[model samples]
Target: MIPEPDPALARSLADDLAAAGYTGARLRALWGVAADEAIGRGRALPARREAAATDSAVAILARLFFLGSPVRESEASAALTNVTIDGAERLGLVRMSSGSVTPSVMIRPQAYVDEHGAGEWWIASDIDESVRPGPLPEDHVLGVGGASLTLAGLQLPTSAARVLDLGSGCGIQSLRARRDSPDVTATDISEAALRFTRLNAQLNAVDGIRTLRGSLFDPVQGEVFDRIVSNPPFVITPRGADVPAYEYRDGGLTGDALVCHIVMGAGVHLVPGGIAQLLGNWEYVDGEDGLHRVRDWIAASPVPLDAWVIERDRMDPIAYAELWIRDGGTVPGTDEFETMLAAWLDDFEARGVREVGFGYILLRRRTEGSPALLRFERVEGAIGPNAALGMHLAESLRAHDRQARLSDAELAEAVLLVAGDVTEARHYLPGAEDPSVIELRQGGGFGRTLAVDPALAALVGASDGDLPVGRLIAAIAELLEVDPDALLSDLLPRVRGLLDDGFLTFAGGEASPSA
Candidate 1:
């Protein structure tokens, strides 16, 4: 079990870590980039080999905290001047036995960048599969992983009065949310997880994050926040199969019911116009689409909500079963692995589950009558490198609200500028003077590609902020010999779409999307 966090010790440890230059980038350079990447996939031998020849303070800390290897007591004492090796043991960060210090928890540097800026935090959590020789304990507290980082990046960069970090495993999301909001409430069912959240917050010297121990919304009942961000334990696991239900990924409930509960119950705790962003998994039953099921969940809400759900990935039942089984430290071709796979398959068959969809969900409580935004789509392709969806989502939400209030004539009178990241791609048949296909591609923000006709292409190419949209449409219609009114009627809605998707923006609002 992790010890209760003492603020004085945490501050000392933070100071020592900073002095030793313990950061993600520095560790990656110490080992080759390939070895660093390998550690993320639960293979630590490469990094272990690379660290064997080094005895620097950073290298020693990397071996103990990152690779989960024991370090000599003398070396650790020399490195941790402020925290001291004795204080570290007292804080339950390590165990000293036979002149060696064995790390009971892992503290590694996490680097992040957002609209505000770039910074690093030292995150502490339970030791991982590299150190444990067998299956993970059912109540393990996980460190920062790919899913955690994805949800962290998805958080909107706007400021808020209060924010909720549901299922705050290691307080990564809490730390990220604290960047925008002054007050953050982090809740989890596991006490160990909540302890890590408190420890992490104090370690980073970030204040105003309070921890509560309860399941889902129970701890935050009757409270309304401006934003709620969660990477919930929504992984579908079978019940009564004797399968290990890890607390970090499994929500104890069967199938996707936990996510359903979240969607159906979010409205009562959200103020009008409040937004909640989360990552979840939904099941696609026999001949039924998962997105449609999510739509149904939204419809069942006691209060109306605006939803924009994106399904980033999907996998069949067998593949999903194998993927999760391997995650619990079970090797393929082992008897235990086969047993667990069979249990998962049997459970899925009972529900008529055909596939599972994983993705991001953004929901907003409608301040007034009826919802305005209802977008459900699949963006399963690769996006541009370092895409900043948080900024894009915030901008798109504003654009949607702006366009919804405007009449067709008012929109046409507004000056517009094409986004800087957009480019035109034309395809032609051999020996043809005119192009057969025209496509506008977005380099960021969902990486959308739209096919356009000659008139639309000409209008976009000429959107240089000098003319009103109406005038540009009139000029393009004249060039194409089409009726001006007819062109306006056809392009008005499409232009609205472009504005909503960040392809085009109102003249003075043309800030480039972040990398």
Candidate 2:
């Protein structure tokens, strides 16, 4: 059930929370450090044990919401002076029965920092397995989780008149989107989810997020948004009696078809030059690559788009099945767990599935271009600091647009600056005077490291915004005794790659999208 929302009471609750200094940092300090870390691993006992020691307002709220501990009515009311015990019950946040206050849902204090600033939100949603007993309900609404944070971090910090948050569970993405876009449209199939979204918006005291109830793009058909973001329910689940389809993860379609539909619909919903970002899972079956299948899905879009999909990791059928089954609250070493595992295995076997690929998908509608970009690859290493990734992505999109218009000769005439966070490392044999390996490592962006031939390394070394790339190439060639034309031919394309990947940015040249 969606929490009953009283905007007036929610505002008071927010005030009370702020006055109590309730935040991710304060909560961690109130409880022991180990207990804080245990919360992420779904082991709430440590936190519960520590929380039991204090009846302070913050501790009480943490125990009630974060640790799922029942609270005494009078104490809870005293802590939340504005919301009060009766008001909390009126807002459907807690149940008052037998003189104790039991939380009907969890309201976590989420801390985040962005280009705008640092802030916190009181995010409310149905409790998960970590805090709840028994199996999760089918229509369970999820609170702040890893996937939500991933999609939240992936949102480009670019300005837009309108933004759309597809499948906005608990409205986390919507809150994040409203950071850049003045107006945001949050959509979902579940009415309860929409209610939670509304309640969350109210709790945050953030305006301009209008919630709509419908599946996919059905709620706002024919409307165009400057940006669309989704952390859709893309989990591939078996369609069987024994298996339970948790609405928070599974999209209730065969395989990754729901993901396919979401990808295909991006073109229809976004305006020209608009962008869509999503996190999804794709299946690899019948000897086909999952990434290529995603490419095909983009190619089949009614509207042309420049696609960049990164496969973070892949899991074989058995491992994937076990992971999801365990996530569904079915512990292993039990008959029910084995039966559910069999159902998943049988489903995969019937479909010829071999593995599942999970990752982020980025699509941008082509403004007008003879050469629309399509980049698909696996990022094997950890992505750089996530908080700054939005700004990084915004710069990347701008760089792509600017560079796409420049030819090889034009690119050579532009001055570039090596990114500040970049460094060069050389490896050599102990007895050798010369280095055998040279790598250009970026400490930011995707945290990529590239092996560079001596000539390319020299070019990067001399790129200090003092001379045009062509002039630098000419000087390096003269010093190294290589032909200038030949050197330019060799390194200009590599320079372009560096520019696109953010190892280098234009110094005196126009590279910013606004420019």
State which candidate has the highest lDDT.
1
lDDT of 1 by residue, 1-515 (tens): 78888899989998888888999888999999899778877789999888867888888898888889899999899888999998898788999999999999999898899998999999999898866677888888999988999888888998888999999999999999999999999999999999999999988999999999999999988999889999999999999756998999999998999999999888778878889999999999999999999999999999998899999999999999999887788889989999999999999999999999999999999876432889899986887548998888988888777777789999999898899999999999999999999999998888999999998898899899999999999998888888999999999999989988999888876333211
lDDT of each: 0.90, 0.87
lDDT of 2: 0.87
The regions of model 1 sitting more than 4 angstroms off are 369-371, 510-515
Scored by TM-score, the top model is: 2
lDDT of candidate 2 over 455-510, digit per residue (tens)? 88988888898898999989889999989999899898888788878988888656
lDDT of 1: 0.90
lDDT of 2 at 297: 97
